[model samples]
Target: MQKRAFTLIELLVVIAIIAILAAILFPVFAQAREKARQTSCLSNQKQIGLGVMQYVQDYDETYPTAYYYKNNTATVNGGSAGGYVHMSVLINPYLKNAQVWVCPSDALRGVGPDNPACADWTNITQIGCEAQVPRLSYIPNSSIMPRKRGPQDAPNVVSMAAVDAPADVIAIGEMTDFSNCIFLGSTGQQNNERRNKSHRPVNAIMRTAGGGQWAGQSVADVTGPIFAITQAAAQGAEGWGGPADTRAITNTAGCRGSAADGGLHIRFMSPGRHSGGSNYMFADGHAKWHRFNDTINPNRFLWGRTYFPSGQPVLDQAGVQVR
Candidate 1:
């Protein structure tokens, strides 16, 4: 037994070797875990894209509208009246698993009352029908033709065939927290009780650009905290519209003042969890990551013009129509 004793110096060396091995292995393990999560997120997007395609096929090749509004009234079922069905409901049957709605990388998951439930498929009771919850991982192409409004009547729902697809048009991408409402924008009007009404239709698309009574003004207004100049500038130039438009990185000089606070700009610049970069599915149905500061011509990114008013080209970089 005496002969079997390990010297103190030998024991110390062994301990140091084990510590070094653990230090080396721990990072490798963490990297592997992150890689797995990223892969799963990609798979989730792929399935979501397939679901969208299926919905389009059955619904006359139309993409779902992200928001809808009527004569000073939020329609029933939100934007469903405008043929804007939530991508969640449109793709629910195809996904076959509700769990796919919440991405594993999203830290905001399960923070709301609807923990573990798919946010997009269900409406949040607290927000009324006008504010349906979103899945947060995917957004339908906003470039699709919007419903046409008449002089004194509700907007006539236009079919999706009216749209033209551009090469770089975004079809789907990651979004922020589902229930946070930080991105909803201004609701317009003070203490507007009408904003609290339930969606007129059972499956309407909630208006992404409008906030609620307490939030004041249309989501387009510059009064809210999310739309402050500093916040907007920090988000990116015209960070109001899409993933590539977010200010998560590379704030441009052009992004100062109202341009920073503009809803449209904010939407254009919002980023995904990847920070300086985000994933985008093009009109052709292929997905890729785009950097926030990439200076490619904006016209190449225009997916469709049918939704914009005649002669109003979709604005691109430099704030001019690309087409």
Candidate 2:
């Protein structure tokens, strides 16, 4: 038999077909990879939620404070670390696995035991993390977590009994990159005492609006960005997570102003990092994914008021939760 080779036309056709297949399959492959990551993130959320529930049960049904300033003791300021003790530290005894604190899809990967913190100058170093603003880290619901910001005394925690609808309240959410506080959307500064120091506390949009640094403010006029634009436009332009109260998709300066100045909080608004949605751990010890807009729907908003252990609703002055 005589040796034969493919004709140029046939070769060209083969190459073209391969190119077409590559184009068609590349996006699908990418999406599959992303889906896996999202699933992994959800798994992390579920484990964390269960761990938190365990912590609550152990702690007399009280939830952990999201973050609190470490008081300086006689030992040394070096050991005191002069920083806040994060919620991740408080619940680690129950979590057991530090790895679950990180989400696979999290570009920031957030802080782990990789960063240690001091409970106080007298206490030894403990598992904790520290990060600057404009980061995509994990966040606990301030409404439920109760934070002790700055030098003031740690505020009382919201007990499990106070959560009227555990399933409806968001306990922990992924990617705190845009939100400055570890306590997601709780109010502070009751009785002229400053807690969670900054106007940033009120930046969550769905925050309980009562006396605090944001005493007189209102999210009523501040429109939800998803409502301001078409769904297609929002997905393409902002993809969730941006500066506080901003509707302009082009404006990417989420960290432009001081969180105390009340001009920014991009992380809370643009929280969804996985396929235009994010994972959340609900108070009822359930974790799931949700489209960002659905969480913010006024009829059933998930980011607002929880209650004090005394059964008083937070942001009590708002009569109804603000935003």
Clashes per candidate, residues 3 or more apart or on different chains: 40, 11
TM-score attained by model 1: 0.57
Model 1: worst 10 consecutive residues (lDDT sum):
196-205
Instruction: Give the per-residue lDDT digits (tens) of candidate 1, residues 163-281.
Output: 45534555555554322222222243222122211111111011231321111113232122221112223243433322344332353323222322233322422254554455655
Model 2 worst lDDT window (10 residues): 210-219
For model 1 the local lDDT of residue 259 reads 29
Which ranges of candidate 1 are over 4 A from the true structure?
A: 1-4, 68-85, 110-135, 145-167, 178-276, 295-311, 316-323
TM-scores vs. true structure, each candidate: 0.57, 0.67
**Best TM-score among the predictions, by candidate number:** 2
Question: Candidate 2's C-alpha lDDT?
Answer: 0.51
Query: What lDDT score belongs to each candidate, Candidate 1 first?
Result: 0.40, 0.51
- Global Cα RMSD, each model: 9.0, 8.5
Tens-place lDDT per residue, model 2, 167-197, is 8888887644432322223232121222222
